[model samples]
Target: MRLTVIGCAGSFPGPDSPASCYLLEADHEGRTWRILLDLGNGALGTLQRFIDPLGVDAVLLSHLHPDHCMDLCGFYVMRSYHPNGAAPPIPVWGPAGTAEQLAAAYGLEDMPGMRATFDFRRYPDAPAGQIGPFSFTATEVVHPVPAYALRVSVGEKVLTFSGDSGPCPALVEAARDADLFLAEASFREVDDNPPDLHLTGRQAGETATAAGARHLVLTHIPAWFDVDTAEDEARAAYDGPLDRARSGAVFDL
Candidate 1:
């Protein structure tokens, strides 16, 4: 299994990093499965730099926020204009109103340019079974908007993503014993004390410790915060191997 950080900025796209997006790929029995965790603003372009967009098999959206989904419009354009006729429909999993939210965001229901692009399968906040080689489960998180943290299992290796959340037991429980925990460290401990919508570095570390994750990858730090300081804070709490994610960083598990 391989995990790639396509983008890691929080709230909005920074000069150095784009918004939230992660790609996970695995191959089993001669079949390749490519899954995108989030497609935040400007991520489509960054994705193109690493992998063929047409190779993406699935997309799991964490929320309806623009920074996390704006580049879905770019995806629509690619599917629409591909010279090899229309591509097969890709499974899109998200919160309850995924279809409506995406249609509205890309004007798909109303815009002809977006409507005929791809097929969409919207799943509510429930266990929606499996997608190819991955089994998935969603847990609600504390955020201004309805957000979900996802647990994805492929064979014996399980990975969890904390998609824009505050300290919550659901996240800890969902990520229990995960091989890789991709957590958001959007703020420093001092500034984000009692964080409302996002996790601080220390909070992320604590979550990884409690969940017993083998590897902790911290992401979503704002450009304003010193990256070194945030990493140190997380390190203070977590004794295990910790990595501060950077754009284009790849992890092989």
Candidate 2:
């Protein structure tokens, strides 16, 4: 499996990276199957640098926040207006009211919204969900908005994504034994952050440490903060291999 950091900025797009998008791809059948974890603000444009947007097999949205899901508007336009004809509807798994939320984000009527362009479905609650060679499970996490942490596994390798959550047991459960823990670190430990909204670098590290995740990648550091500080704070808690998610970085497992 291959994971690409298309965007890593938190809350909003940063100069160095766009907001909260990650591309996960793996070989299935005779070809590659690609799924995006999130398509946040400014992510659609950056995504083209890696793979054809039309080639994405599925998209799993973490929440309805603009920085986490606003690009569906542009994506809807792309697939619906392709010169060859409308592309096949891609499966989009997200929280409840996903179709309505995306439609509202795109200034469209809530009835159909992007339904014709994308097949929107609520994330499967139990027994996991499957598409091609991957299986993913979602766990509710601590966030003011309805958010989830996803744990995706293909064969023996596991990849977990903490999609905008504060320190919580659900986050630890979602990351348990993951080969790569792509965690969000939006606030510095020194700052006074709101509870149940986001995680500090230290909290992210603590979660990974508690989950026994093998590797940790700190992501979603807002543009206002220094990424180095998050890394430093994480290092103090986690002894495993740690990396900061940068635009275009690839991790093959």
Candidate 3:
């Protein structure tokens, strides 16, 4: 599987990167299967630089925050109004009421809203879905609104994404023994951070340490925070292969 970092900015769009969007691609049959982790602010424009929007096989949203799923509106337009023709509806897995929220955001009627462009499906708590060669597992994480920490596995290789979360057991459980853990280190360790919200750089590293993740990629740091600070804090807690996620960064496994 190939992991491409489309955006890594936290909470909102940054000057250099978009919000929180990731692209995962793997080979299935004779073609490549693609799935997007999130479609955050300013991701649509940047996404086309990597792959054609029509080639997206599925989109898995971590939550309903504008910074996490807002760009779906722009994606809906491209898929619904392509010059060649309307693109086929692709699966969109998200939190409960995801369909309603997207519909309201795009100002669409209740019936067939963005559903015409996207086949929106709510993530099931017990049995997660499998798409092509990937198996997805979503664990509820501590956040203001409904959100999840996602673990995607292809055979033995695994990639875990800690979608905006504070210190929690579920987050650790979701990332257990992951090959690559993409953690959000939005808040710094020195700040007076809140609970059940976001992770500090040290906290992100601690989670990676506890989960026994092989490689840790610190991401989702807002422009206000320095990546060096996050790396310094994370390095203190974890002693593994670590890298700061940046736009256009690619990881192959």
lDDT of 1 at 153: 88
Q: Name the best candidate (by lDDT).
A: 3
- What is every candidate's alpha-carbon RMSD to the true fold? 2.0, 1.1, 1.0
Model 2 misplaced regions, further than 4 Å: 124-127
In candidate 3, which residue pairs clash? none
List ranges where model 1 is wrong by over 4 Å: 110-116, 192-195
> Any idea how many clashes model 2 has?
0
C-alpha local distance difference test of each model: 0.84, 0.92, 0.93
lDDT accuracy of residue 243 in candidate 2:
99
Poorest 10 consecutive residues of model 2 by lDDT? 122-131
lDDT of 1 at 38: 87
lDDT of 1 by residue, 42-127 (tens): 89989998999999988888888888887888897787668987777787777766667777876656444343554455546355
lDDT of 2 at 224: 92
